[model samples]
Target: MKDKQVLEFDLIIAGGGAVGCLLALSLRSCGLKIAIVEASAYACDSQQSLHPGFDARSIALSHQSASYLQQLGLQSSLLENCVPIKQIKVSDQGHLGQCWLDHRQQRVEALGYVTSQQQLGTMLYESVKDADDIDWFCPDSVSDVKQHQQHIDVILSSAKRLSASLLVVAEGGSSPTATKLGFQSQVQDYQQVALVANVKTDHPHEFRAYERFTAQGPLALLPNADSSFGLVWSLAAEHRDTFLHMQNSEFLQQLQQAFGYSVGRFVALSQRNSYPLALARLARTVAHRSVVIGNAAHTLHPIAGQGFNLGLRDAQCLSTLLRNTVKQDGDPGAAPVLQVYSQQRHQDQSLVVNSTDALVRFFSNNHGPLVAGRNLGLGLLDLCGPLKLKLGRAAMGYGGQNAAS
Candidate 1:
């Protein structure tokens, strides 16, 4: 079945990041032809330094997200490096109100888990390595795109053109491919930057994650395994350059001030990374025969760490839709089929987009009244048992419906 000149596929995914690879694997068991175009040359590396993109950014996966990975047989592999999240503590720094989300109440051993960006990416790549249905064209780039009534064609950087009925764009923020497919993004300059690093803590942290609001923005310390924790401190962009240039000692001292004595001594710290924070939402989900997924569709604030998990949910749901459609002898890329998938998955997706957006605006304001109001709400939530449980479940990715797609 080797074609000498051109290769054709039922689906061609442009970004082979976490979501793209997982999407291909999820649908591999289904009857479909697939090809993955990854811009990067290599997918994974066991050694940390050898991997270029791991960065310091980590993820806090919710329950439904965990179950989705479990269903995909990636749970075991992921758990090897994951840090279980037992609870989340939310409060306004130096304020009276606080709320705790306990995983035990949600009938789960762990609320969620934390893993590095590079580790997650590597695990996903390995998971899809043997998927026979997907022809992973790594060290490849999408040079050009053309949409015809019959098929969508992608010209590779190598000057080879490939055609498919559907294309999933998983590239990074403001993906050119998504834009070419008529996707428009609503960008909000939060005027903030996220500063991330890993630090050794004296206290156990007890697998408890903390979200504290300071004058600059939301300061979160997500617990990792051992006596270490990861930091995602959102600061005003006007002040980012200053903080980004601070020596490790100076930065740790400032972090200690905002973090108080919770994490004990922060030591053996790694280098810091600063990323501009913004929310880019696509006006529509699908355009022509191409659909945007992951960061290509939306980029949310890191306040809740739901950015990546939300993208994973998209992959799961989309794969489910395609699998069911193919079982019915249907073309997975038909406009009618794509429309249904977009609509059914809209509410949950929108909720995440809106909630993350609201969270940043809600906590970023340093005004007096807003601060008081937020603290009062936190106190009220802390006192309300049923409400607290609901919040816990919601934060664990079970807020609306199930973690389908």
Candidate 2:
């Protein structure tokens, strides 16, 4: 640790979200000087309140992503509370349409994991608490930013100036700061909103996640450790309010209608959240002395629950780039360096976004011809081992280095 409190660092990150915080913590063992400029300080005591054992929003993490998390020294404690999604079930309601994917059929130990987004944050937060190298700033935000050949300077809302060789923004999909820094994005509002909640089921989920396509949209029920399914129910934006305002009994009935009986009866749910759905792709993933990770760079449909996986892959790829560069005495924040990082990330993200978006469109309609074609496609996929394998691999995020680390 440096003796002086206000000092420069090798990296300064904007936004204290999971991605940004994980980036700093990942680089800790390198002993590189780093500081995080969080918009909000831990000003509110409520911020420290850890929900039950896990968060409402969970993640479908690929084997590669799990390995990457483990590589960062985070799997043991993280997995302790996480449920292993041994298989994934994709089907439609009432048509007897269903397909199953398991590691054995896929020739892997496990397809992925069902992990709580907040639990991972909590684990990282605890793990990094004693690491003296990475400085965290919360309850404060970056007000002004300046970049030059040598370093980047930032003025916080508190009028404090901080500098670093490189800056990373991992706030979320929509960030004004990233926009001001010349980050233009191609955003497609799904015209839909994802309604998230949890529900206790009569039968155990058996460690499986379901992505059931419907006329309204795709409703996903990911397994919780208990006999419950964490739901990410997406519907057309126009109908979102109806779902939000439904009385408890009405909500449960609609949930039953949307989710179906794969998980049995619904008892109750909590931590309900409604978010606007969209696909936003940044024009350029990196620049002179800064880079974007997490939701700030790209956000995809939750149809596959691959949003965080995409961000985790970004972090892993960026870490590899940084590691390889310093090993060769290359500048970490060089334009060419950042550009390379962007290129590598762009190709991989393209596939994820396209596949997820296509699935959303294919499933969220009632066209007679389209319905028949999709049902045929699903049937064909089930019959053909090679085709099914291809999709399983793709969904498991093995498209390329963009996914499989």
Q: If candidate 1 were superposed on the true structure by all CA atoms, what would the RMSD be?
A: 2.2
Error of 1 at 394 (Å): 1.7
lDDT of each candidate versus the true structure: 0.82, 0.77
- Per-residue lDDT tens digits for candidate 1, residues 1-405, read 323566789899988877888798788768889999877777244454312444446778777787788888887887887888988889888787888888877878888888877777777777887788878787788888888786788889987778888888988688888877778899999999998888877778898999999876798888876558888899999998888887888877887777778667876677788889999999888877888888889899999878887888888888888888889998777898788778877887899999888999989887899989999999999889899998887788877655453
Which candidate has the highest lDDT of all? 1
Lowest lDDT sum, 10 consecutive residues, model 1, at: 43-52
TM-score of each: 0.95, 0.92
Any runs in candidate 1 off by more than 4 Å, and if so which?
A: 1-4, 43-53, 403-405
Deviation in angstroms for 209 in model 1? Answer: 0.8
Q: How much does each candidate deviate from the true structure in C-alpha RMSD? A: 2.2, 3.0
